[model samples]
Target: MSIEELNQELTRLRQCLQQLKTDNAELRQAVLEYTTQLKQHKSEQQAALLERQRIEEQLQTTQQFLYSVIQTMPVAVFVKDVVDLRIVLCNQAAEKLAGVSADEILGKNDYDLFPREEADFFTTRDREALNSKKLLEIPEEIIRTKSGETRILQIKKAPILDSQGQPKYLLVVRYDITEHKQAEAQLKQQAIELEQTLKELQSTQAQLIQSEKMSSLGQLVAGVAHEINNPVNFISGNLTYANKYIQQLLNLLHLYRINYPNPAQEIQMTIQEMEFDFLVEDLLKLLSSMEIGAERIQQIVVSLRIFSRLDEAELKAVDIHQGIESTLSILEHRLKPRANHVEIQVLKDYDDLPLVECYAGQLNQVFMNILSNAIDALEEALIQGKLSHNHPQIRICTQQLNAQQIVIRIIDNGLGIPEQVKQKLFDPFFTTKDVGKGTGLGLSISYQIITERHGGSLECVSSLEEGAELIITIPVVQPKQ
Candidate 1:
């Protein structure tokens, strides 16, 4: 009985052991499957983590690129919250314009950054942009930096909207235009100066032309004067000789008539037919008249020669008073009373002066022109009823200024020039006289002659309703040309 039971128990034990072995094998297989699954899961998790990290790096790079673009932009860029109106974003250019770093300007409002007036203006514009909910452009806006530098800006303000289409921020972009404005202003000033220079050149060109014409005219007058001088001198000399010869003949005839009371019958008949007594007395008078006419012709020839001074080509030391006298003598008729007006009184106050070294011919011409102008002025005053207090007068005064200079003042009582006109008195082709009456070159030419030719100054002092005084200052010793 023991052997059978033992065998049975052993059989059961073998079966159990076999089952346990099978279970152990199954458990090992399960564990291997679980290890493979665990490794796969861990690999999948690592791949997901890498993808997430790559995505994060891309996002960071994109943000940095946007920041770099904003910082490097030429124009100043600023972002302000639409609700609180506080600066939220400031670019490098914005910081530069604000004269501060980004940290100093990032969270500041216009009121916090700018003056009260500028802040008010900027905020008002920002509000308008926000209200408009669109881009707003300001053509020009002035901004003062913390460094006290002023700049003009072209501003573009736009509202940044959220996904819900509501304004979230105001984006302000501004371009500085200070340098551009300054360049424009400089260009304008240069243009003005260039125009003035062009005007001066034109005036000088016209003056040169006028001087050439005057030189030609002077040559012609000089030639005419020379031609008249020779003939007038011959005539004057012959007339004097003829007058003396006639006087001698008359005396001899009177002596003969007294000695031989009874004359020839033919001579007495001729005398009686010719009204002898009346002819005798009239003959003497006629001879005297002829002599006087010859003398007057000689004087006119002298005056014309003096006025022209054609022979005096180079500079010479001469008396200034003589030059004035020659000019007055040449213009005596103009000064004398005409059928319509009274004679203009000329007063001379001449100092005892040394002989001035000058071009005598040109000096005489200057004196003539000045005296002629004076006469014209006096005549104009008389005609215009400006000589109410007294008659027209021209006073010419010569003074020895210093060892080096001389002064000649020609004063005239006349209707004077306006202040505005006086400033332009020396400009070529500028005149107050009528178009035909004045070439507008007399005073201009005179000024040129005195200033350029003689190194002198010709100045006029006058105002409306006041008399004019033309003071000429010249160096006594002429500078070598």
Candidate 2:
């Protein structure tokens, strides 16, 4: 009985021991799993902390870069609150421009720093920008700083929107533009002045041309008068003789009648006293002289009328040669008055040229100026002993350069202009002659009429101690644009 009982108890004890060992092994596995889980959680937390630090550093760098960029920009930048229209933010440029520190200007309205009028203008513009929710640019404006310095500003304004698409602030940018505007104004003024000067010069030139023409006309009148005086005097003497002869013839008739009436002695005495035969011969001679004188006077009057046709205002096709002849007639007096030892000879090389379309009166003036100057040159040469024994000559040549162009040259052997004087010969009020003797405008006006008014060219060529040649080239036909 004892042996069976012992074996059963031992078996029970062995079973319990095995169960305890299994529970211990399970507990050890559970501890190792918990330790691995704790280690993994610590590693994840450390990685998250490092990521957060890196993002913070990046955010700080971005803020610093934006601040630096805004401060260094040339344009003044400012921001205002939309609701209150008060300045909320301003850059360093804006602060400097306003002549105030940032602390004093922040949160201040425009009215606090500027006059009421200026403030209202700024506020109106800001409101318009905010209402439109678009950029507004003003090309120019007047801005006054806190230091009372005024400047012209070019401004651009834009509205800033919040995340909800609501207007949050107004952004304004400004640049000074005073100097540029001033320069533009000055340039415009200078242009106006230049235009006025050109007009004045043109007017002065026209007056000069008129004066030269009048002088030529006066000379022409004197010459025509002198030429007619001799014929008129002869005609007057012949008419007186003819009247005396007619009286004598009447007396002879009366004496013959009386003698037949039975008074022979008295009739014979009257006939002898009258000298009837001689009176008859003289009367015929006087009548012939009077007829010749009347014809000569008619010719002069016709020539004068033809030459003065230039006084008309209408433009016409005119023969250039005829115009030249008329000008010579006008200058005839000047030539004869100085006809001493100096012989004035004219060499004409006129070609068969077509009529030119021009203002006859104005063109005549141009011719008169040139011809008068030439005559004066010859006179000067005579007075200065430069024309001794040598023939003082004037040459006039006309030629058709082409179908559309004509050239006329006037050459004179006189005291030629010096190079220095020649450069300014066409300048108004410049003359080599004494004051009151010559008006310094003849050549200047001639230049304007030839070049500016008629689109022709008038040029002078001369050498020291040589002769002067004036060449005028004009277009025969004006071209249509």
Candidate 3:
């Protein structure tokens, strides 16, 4: 019994040992698996920490770069909180513009930094920018610094957006523009002064040229009139006597014919062959024609003298109509028909006017210029086939405008001047004619004569295809210097 029991106990003991070995093996495997899992978790934690550190460094670098950009800009830059419109960030330029330190400017609202009116304006603009989420530009604004100095500025405001596309802050930029504005104004003033000086120089030049021209013309005309006057006086004086002698001779012949009714055959044949009766009538007719021609020559000589007016240099009361007629006489040849061109007819409407106090010779010269220009316009119309009326004509009208003033108007039926061309018509050296055909100073000088020399006004009215009218108004008595 002891042996059997011993053998059974030994087998049980071996089985139990085997069971314990299996359990120990399973326990070792579980411990190894737990150790491997713990190592993997620790590695994952380390990688996450490294990535977080790297992100923090990148964020710091980006902030530094943005700050540097804002600090170095030339313009005054400010950043404000969207909620309270309070300034959160400012650059050195902003501090200088405000004439204050950054410590005082930071975390302050516009109301605290500026006057009430300026603050209101700034706040309104900030709100508008934030609400619209767009950039706003102000072309100009006035700002008073801490030193009480006024300055002009151009400003721009923009809303900074966040990741969710919402406004986070307001950014403002301002540029000083006072000096630029002042320079622009100075340039404009200088330009005006230069233009005035140019006008004065041109006027002086015109006066000199016209004076020389008028003097030369006067000398030549005076000489011609003197020469013609002597001849015309002699011829006119002799024609009267010759006419009387012819009448006496005809009376003597009549007496002989009455007294010697019966004559010798030879004498009667002579009288018949000579046609004595017809000869007597024809001779009287010839004498009458000679007298008329002599008178016409005398009148022409007088007209020439009047037109010269070399001695009438000072202002004097003159017959305006006589001066006009003299100018027409001088330009008669130009008014006549030319090759392939019709005659230019002139119509006059005269009013009763008193003698005007003016320089006679100078006034005549003005008349000559205006009339010549009218003729040129008519001729140009004919050349270009732009004449509205078949008969190219000039109309001259005169009237007393008031008790102290008189007006004259010269109108033409021709191709009218364009508005653009008419504006510069009175300028010196401005002309529509060929370079050689015109000096281009005639109208300019005429304008000076009427306005500056005689204290008058000259105006031109014209339209395209509707002809032109030039009007002149002058005082009857000039103002005393």
Candidate 4:
């Protein structure tokens, strides 16, 4: 009985052991699978931690980049909360323009830093940009800074929208234009000053021309007079003796003829051949012609002296008729007809004028200038065949304009000047003639002499169809020195 029980118990134990082993094996397999799952979970957790760290670093970098971009911008940039119309951000340029720190400007409003009127304008612009949801540009605007300085600015505002497409903020960019405005004003002032300077220089130069012209004319007259005087003196001194000697010879011949009524045949033949009656008549005529020519020479010298008036620098009583006649004598050659050119007829209608109290040398220069210009006009007309039908002409008239003024008019019958050109007639360097043909300073110099030196008015009256007429009116009683 004991053997059987022992065997059975052993088998039962064996069965239990086998069962325990099976359970242990299954438990080990389950543990290995759980270990593999735990290792995979650990790996996944490490990857997730690394991903979160990278995302955090990227977010930090992006924030830094945006902050740097807004700060480094050159233009005056500002960001304003559209809802409250308050400033949310400002750049360095904005801080400089506002005369305040960027940190102080942030969260502050335009009303806090600027005047009420300026604040109103700024707020209005911000709201308009937000409402329109578009970029708004103002070409010009004036704003007072925190430093109490005014600046002209060009402003541009852009609408910054939210995710829901609602108004969020205004991004304002301002460009200052004060310097440009100031520069423009300066340029304009400089231009005005330049024009005035040009006028002054022209006036100075005109006076110089008048003085030089008179001096030159005086010297020329003296030289010509000295040259002609020698020839004239020799002829005048000998002419009296020559005439007396001829008269004496003629008397002796008559006496001889009277005393000897009957002559030798040879003497009669010689007298007949000699033509003694005709010979004696012609000798007297020759002497008279010499006297007349010498007289003409003396008259020309007198006219030249009158015209020069070299010593008349200051005011003097001068004969206007004598001045006119002297100018005419100098211009005699121009008035005469020439080959392929017609004579310029000058008509002088001079009134009985009082003795003009003026600078005589300068007065002579004026006469010469006016007369010369008139001749030039006539010549131009002739060259263009304009004077072929109507003869070239100049009319000079002088009269008492009033109790204290005298007027001299120089009118020409040539191609008329245009209104635009006539307006600049007396301006220095202005001319109607071709380049190098004229200096263009003659009339300008003359005008300054008549107006500035003598207290007068010189003006041109002309039209396109009718020719030019220059009028000069001088005070009869000049200002006392």
Candidate 5:
């Protein structure tokens, strides 16, 4: 009985021990799984911590880069709070421009750093910029620095907007432009001075050339007149005496013929062969023709001498119409009809003007230049078919404008000058003629002679498809020098 009971207890104990061993194994597995889960969780936490650190470091680097950019910018840069309009940030350039240190400039309002008027202007602009939420540019502004130095600045203001589309700050950039403006003004002044100097040089050169030309022309014409006068005088003096002597011989021969009517046959035959009656008539006519030719030569010589006016150096009262007639005589060959060109007719309406006190030779030169140009213009018009149906004509009219002044107008019916060309007509070296056809100084010299030398005004009036008229007004009597 004792052995069976003991064995039953032992079995129960064994069952309990087996259950305990199973529970211990399950507990160990649970602990291993928990340790693995805890390691994984820790690894994930470490990675997240590293990512956060990297992001913070990158953000710090970006901030430093931006700060460097703002400080080193050349233009004066300022950042002001939108609400208070107080400068919160400024670059090194701004401090220098304001003539103050960053420590003194930062966190200061415009009123604190500038005059009341300037402060008001700056604040008004800042507010406008913020309200507009766009960039505003002021082309020019003047500001005085702390050191009392004045500066011109071009300013640009822009609003810094936040993500919510609201103005956060006002950014101001100013560029100094004082030096540029000064240089521009200096260059402009220099350009004006240079243009004046060039014009003076041109005028001087034209004067020298014209003076030499007139001197040479006068010498040549005087020489020609002298050379022709002697021969013409000789021929003219001899023709009269020869005509009288021949008439005396013819009268004596008529008496001989009458008294010796019953002369020898040989004498009669010789008289008939000689045609004595026709010979007497023809000889008189030939002598008359020679005298006329001699007179024409003398008139030409006179015209040449008058045109040259070599002796009239000093100012003298002279007939203006005489000068005009001499010029026409010199240009007579050109006015006549030529190959493929019609005659250029000249009409003169000259008033009985009082004698004008002037340099006679110079006045003649002006007439020559004006008439020559008119002839050229008429020829040009004919060549261009502008005067196809109408003949080319030039009309010259003179009048007494007032007690002291006189007016002379030269008009031409030709291809009229364009407004643009006519505006520069009297300018030196300006020409409408082809290269080598003109010297381009004729009208310019004439204008100078009338306006500067004679104290007058010269102007042209013309329009397209119409004729051109050049009016010259001068005082009749020379003013005391």
Candidate 6:
């Protein structure tokens, strides 16, 4: 009984021990699987951490690049929140222009730094850009800085949209344009001043021409009056003598009637008293003198009429020689007194030429001015004793340069103009003569009429003590319309 029980118990104990060993093995396998899974999970977590760090570094680099680009830009750049109209971001240029730091300007409204009016302008522009979702470019504007200085700026504004396509901020770019505006204003002012100066010059020229014409008329009137007086006086004296002779002849006829009645004594007395032969000869002489004086008066009147034809303002063909001759005749009185003992010689070298189309009155004025100057030169020479009375001469020549041009040259042997004076001879109010004696506008006006009005040239060629030669060249044909 004891052996059988021991064997069964031992069998039970072995089965239990085997079961314990199997359970231990299964637990070890399960622990190894759980350990491998835990190691794999730790490796995956480490790789994820490194990837996160790498992405963070890339993000830092991107932010630095964006900051550098915004700072280095030349034009002023700034961003403002559209919702609250507050400055969101600003570059280095914008901060420099504002005279403030980015930290101070950020989240600040434009009105805090600029005037309300200027701030309103910026607000209006920003609003328009956001509403239209398009860029707004203003070629020019004025911006006030924190220092209360106004700066001209060319500005461009654009909207920045959010992910929902809604405008979130406005980007503004500006450049200084003050110098360009100032230059434009200066140019405009200069142009106006130049135009005014030109008008003044033209007016002065016209006045000079008018004054010269009046002076010429005054001289002509005086000379013509003197010339007319002489002939009129002679004619009056001759008529007076003729009247006395007519009375004597009447008395002689009366005596002849009385002698018919008493024939001898009365006839002899009347003949003695009347001086019949003398009376007849005196009447004939008086009548001839009157006739000559009348002829002289008529000739002077004709010349007077021709010399005063400067009142009209029309162009016509006029013979140059006739004009020269008329001018000489008008100036004859001034010439005669000086030429009395000098034996003045005149040389004429006239060519056959066509009549020039010009304002006759104006051309005559030119001739009078030139010829009068010549006469004055000769007189001055005589007074100064520069001439020795050895055939002192005045020469005039007219020649045709071509079919369309003619030249009139007036040369004298008087003292010539000085070198320094020659340059200003044709300028108004510049003259070599004494102040009261000459107005200094004769040559200037003559030059105007010839060159500006008639499209001609008037020039003087002279040397000290060598006499002067003035050449005037005019076109034969009229200028084109």
Which 10-residue window in model 2 sums to the lowest lDDT?
A: 302-311
Model 4, 1-481: lDDT tens per residue? 6999999999999999999999999999999999999999999999998999999899999988987887788779888887687888888888888888987888888888888988898888888888899999999999988788999999999988889998788889998878988998899999989987987787677657656756886889978977888888888888888888889988998999999977999999988998978888887888899899898787777778878876676788888778878878878889999996978888999998998888877777888887798788778778777764567888989999778889888898877788888778888778888999887788888888898889998888877657778888888778897
Best candidate per TM-score, number?
5
A best-first ranking of the candidates according to their TM-score comes to 5, 3, 1, 4, 6, 2
Question: Which of the two, 3 or 4, has more TM-score?
Answer: 3
TM-score of each: 0.66, 0.46, 0.68, 0.64, 0.70, 0.48
Q: For residue 114, give model 6's deviation from the true position in Å.
A: 47
**Tens digits of lDDT, candidate 5, 384-462:** 7778656889899999988899888989988778989998998888888899998778888888889888999889999
Q: lDDT tens string, model 2, 425-477? A: 88876788887877777787888778876789999999866878999888886
Error of 1 at 293 (Å): 4.4
Q: Candidate 6 — which residues are off by over 4 angstroms?
A: 1-289, 310-312, 338-343
lDDT string, candidate 1, 256-337, tens digits: 9899888889988998899977987998898788778767766766766666666776787888888788778778888888
Compute the lDDT for candidate 3: 0.88
Which segments of model 3 are wrong by more than 4 Å?
Answer: 1-75, 80-86, 91-172, 239-297
Residue-by-residue lDDT tens digits, candidate 3, 99-166? 99999999999999889999998899889999999999999999899889898999999999999999
lDDT for position 363 in model 6: 77
TM-score: model 4 vs. ground truth: 0.64
Task: Kindly give the stretch of ten consecutive residues in candidate 3 with the minimal lDDT sum.
Answer: 296-305
* Clash number by candidate, in order: 0, 0, 0, 0, 0, 0
State the local distance difference test value for candidate 1: 0.85
lDDT of each: 0.85, 0.79, 0.88, 0.84, 0.88, 0.80
